[model samples]
Target: MRIRLARPEDSAALLRIYAQYIHSPVTFEYALPTEPEFAARIGRISETYPYLVCEENGGISGYAYAHRQAEREAYQWNAELSVYLDAAAASRGRGTRLYRMLLDILPLQGVRSAYALVTLPNAASERLHASLGFRTMGVQSEAGFKAGAWHDVAWFVKDIAPHDAAPRPLLPVSRLDADVLRRILDTRG
Candidate 1:
């Protein structure tokens, strides 16, 4: 498996992986985004954060990304993460590997905290987050209504960097040292 930065052109393939979850509680989104919309999302988020894809056997098997947790200036150092894998890729450790790379990259971008929201009863996702050192902060009861029922969301957080009193300004993913970013993407588990 190889991990790399995602590109706008990858929208179709990535969407294929994401579409599988639209009918389930795995994600709160009710519809699959159009290719252009999805590509725009990749472009916008990649401007300041990490958006990555995992390629296995020449096909995209999964993806993961981080975006601002909140728009407030004070929240610049915090980010929310999401990961999705092709059905064929589940249970093979690809999600863990993709998230590991994402977690590793965030600190370099000056992200202090990484948060994730997992819909209730998603044992696999909950286990994945816990194994990565995220603690369950709380649960939002009936956070969203989908698939004809209400589903709760569990909030998980992990400190990716030291919370200094005066933290340095965030370094956009585009500004990270190429050599350093390359090394992170090339790392193997």
Candidate 2:
């Protein structure tokens, strides 16, 4: 598997992987967005953060990204993390590879803390986050309704870098040198 930055062209494959989670309690989304909407989402996120996809044999198998944790400027140093892997790609360590690359890149963008909100009973996801040094902060019971029932969400957090009283503005992924960005994804933990 190879990890690289996400492209708008990968939206269809990315949506396919994400739509599956919407049906299960793994995600809170009720309906899948249209292809154009999804493409716009990819474009919007890549503007200021790291949105990555893992390709295996030339097909997108997994993806991960970090977005603003809150809209307020006070939250600039914090971001929410998300990851999805195709069913066929699960159990092959693709999620780890994608997530590690995302985590590795966010700090370079001035992110001090990264958070994940995982739907309850998702042992696999919880384990993956925990294995990467995230600590369970708390669980929000019945935070969302999905699949005709209420589902809880577990919040986990990891500090990627030191927090300072004044943090520099986040650096867009596009600002990073091509060779440096390539090395970041290609080098393994």
The prediction achieving the highest TM-score against the true structure is 1
Model 2 ranges off by over 4 Å: none
Worst 10 residues of 1 by lDDT: 180-189
The TM-score of candidate 1 is 0.98
Task: State each model's CA lDDT, in order.
Answer: 0.94, 0.88
Clashing pairs in 2: none
Residue range 22-69, candidate 2, lDDT tens digits:
788887777898889899999999998989988888788889998999
Question: What is the Cα-based TM-score of model 2?
Answer: 0.96
List where candidate 1 sits over 4 angstroms from the true fold.
none
True-structure RMSD for candidate 1: 0.9
lDDT, residue 99, model 1: 91
Give residue 54's lDDT in candidate 2 (0 to 100): 86
